[model samples]
Target chain A: MTTIADPKAPRPPKPRPARLTTRGNTELYGWVFMRASGVVLLVLIFGHLFVNLVAGEGVTAIDFGFVAGKWASPFWQVWDLLMLWLAMIHGTNGVRTIINDYAERDGVRLALKSALYLAFVLVVVLGTLVIFTFDPCPSGSPADLLPSFCTA
Target chain B: MPDALPASATRKVPAGTLYRGREGMWSWVAHRVTGVAIFFFLLVHVLDTSLVRISPEAYNDVIATYKNPIMGLGEAGLVAAIVFHAYNGIRIILVDFWSKGPKYQRVMLWVVMGLFVVTMAGFLPRHLMHVFGGE
Candidate 1:
């Protein structure tokens, strides 16, 4: 039998083999996530655009009252929440892969990825908070501008 | 990847253009470009949207900028990028998952482009009317 030395076999500590793939399935999952999230994002974003820019007065109708009316409903709130999370995650991962590819230097890649991740965290957190904690109608505000739902 | 070519490779091939393959490579490039553009816009958009928490006036004031003609044109372009990215993304998913995807990838790219044109055609006229309809 040919002697096949096991890489993980315990022996005297020697130089670790070059190009050892310690990252098992991480890249694979990232690839799969991109496609999966992408499929859903196409639907979510298309609907979002259609509603916000195609229906009603289109872009002209988008205002504080417009946003307030939509978010007031649990349905749209959940809808936006899903859109926010999925879009951010998908965009962040795509950017991260690009940074890894183009930023050749180790320090450069690290710095770029750090900035990318920071933006991801900041955007995701802020969006989530804004969606859930949003007060559609503040007290002592412009009554005329407020959505009718606020009066009710 | 910088290693030697295969045994049949005796001819001197052009360098630095390997990444610039035909339809597949260009589509990949477009995907990356659109993805990056959309990502930056999303960051700005999220920040603009977060202003809603500050006050209603703050939010409306910012969103009003988005209704101007210049921004209206920009929105059209953004929608174009989004439509292309969305359709191409579906094409990529099909290529990865479908059994007959590779055989028909070129056909699917055409399909993607076709869908993109039809979608933008539907969106642009109405959106431009809203923006420039002087309402």
Candidate 2:
């Protein structure tokens, strides 16, 4: 029995397109981050080099005193804090890419990445702690060895 | 997959361009090498810098060792590596984002090298003087 079909049937909504990658935009974001961080790091690092290595007396001037002097200021504390975080993240990602490239064996790649992540976490955490918790002067230390401001 | 199949056994006789790679490929290799070197250096640098938390004397003592002439020259090399990596990194960014960047990547590499030499020129003499000047 052939029956005439109704001309006014409603249509179903269109299905979403299949994802090209299961991992999504993670790699893309990583790529973008490298470039973005690379730009900022140029300024941070170049200024760092200029002050530390190219300034008056150069590397010879660096010591506990010099470091304490710098860190005593909130400005430099923040500078170093930013440098620490950004440089580590940027550097670690670069290494991760290299590992993915050369470490053909699965287990080797996994082992290498494990070690890398462990180092990254350790360094970042320790560095952040040292920066925030650092003391310009100790109670019993000889004042001569410390930054002059520490005694003053 | 065959262990016995050395390329000499095939008829191909190394005819094309010898695969030494041009500017783009070499720049990529250089960027990776310098990046790895900088990564390792950063690790050591952070560790050494952290010595300050222990005691002022401890930190100073470790840092003073770096003032020697040998380490001074090594520092120069380190700076050189960093400069190259930095400039090449900018080039890479341009290549990725700028529409005309791929066409001029070779030129950009030259520009990177040019800038690198200038920066090192400004840096080395000053640093070497500080290290060896004995003032």
- TM-score for all predictions? 0.88, 0.87
| Model 2 C-alpha lDDT per residue in residues A65-140, reported as the tens digit of each score | 8999999999999999999999999999999999998898999999999999999999999999999999989778
Write one digit per residue (lDDT tens) for candidate 1, span B25-105. Answer: 999999999999999999999999899899888998888777789999999999999999999998888888899998888
Root-mean-square deviation per candidate: 6.9, 9.4
Give the Cα-based TM-score of candidate 1 against the true structure: 0.88
Interface root-mean-square deviation (Å) of every model: 0.7, 0.6
Give the share of true interchain contacts found in each model: 0.88, 0.83
Q: What is model 2's DockQ versus the real complex?
A: 0.66
Which digits, one per residue and each the tens of the lDDT, describe model 2 over residues B1-135?
457786667854456643568999899999999999999999999999999999998998899888799999989988999899999999999999999999999999999999999999899889989989755
Stretches off by above 4 angstroms in model 1 are A1-19, B1-14, B18-20
Q: Which candidate number would show the highest TM-score if scored against the true structure?
A: 1
Name model 2 segments beyond 4 Å from true.
A1-20, B1-20
> What is the Cα-based lDDT of residue B41 in candidate 1?
93
Candidate 2 whole-model C-alpha lDDT, 0 to 1:
0.91
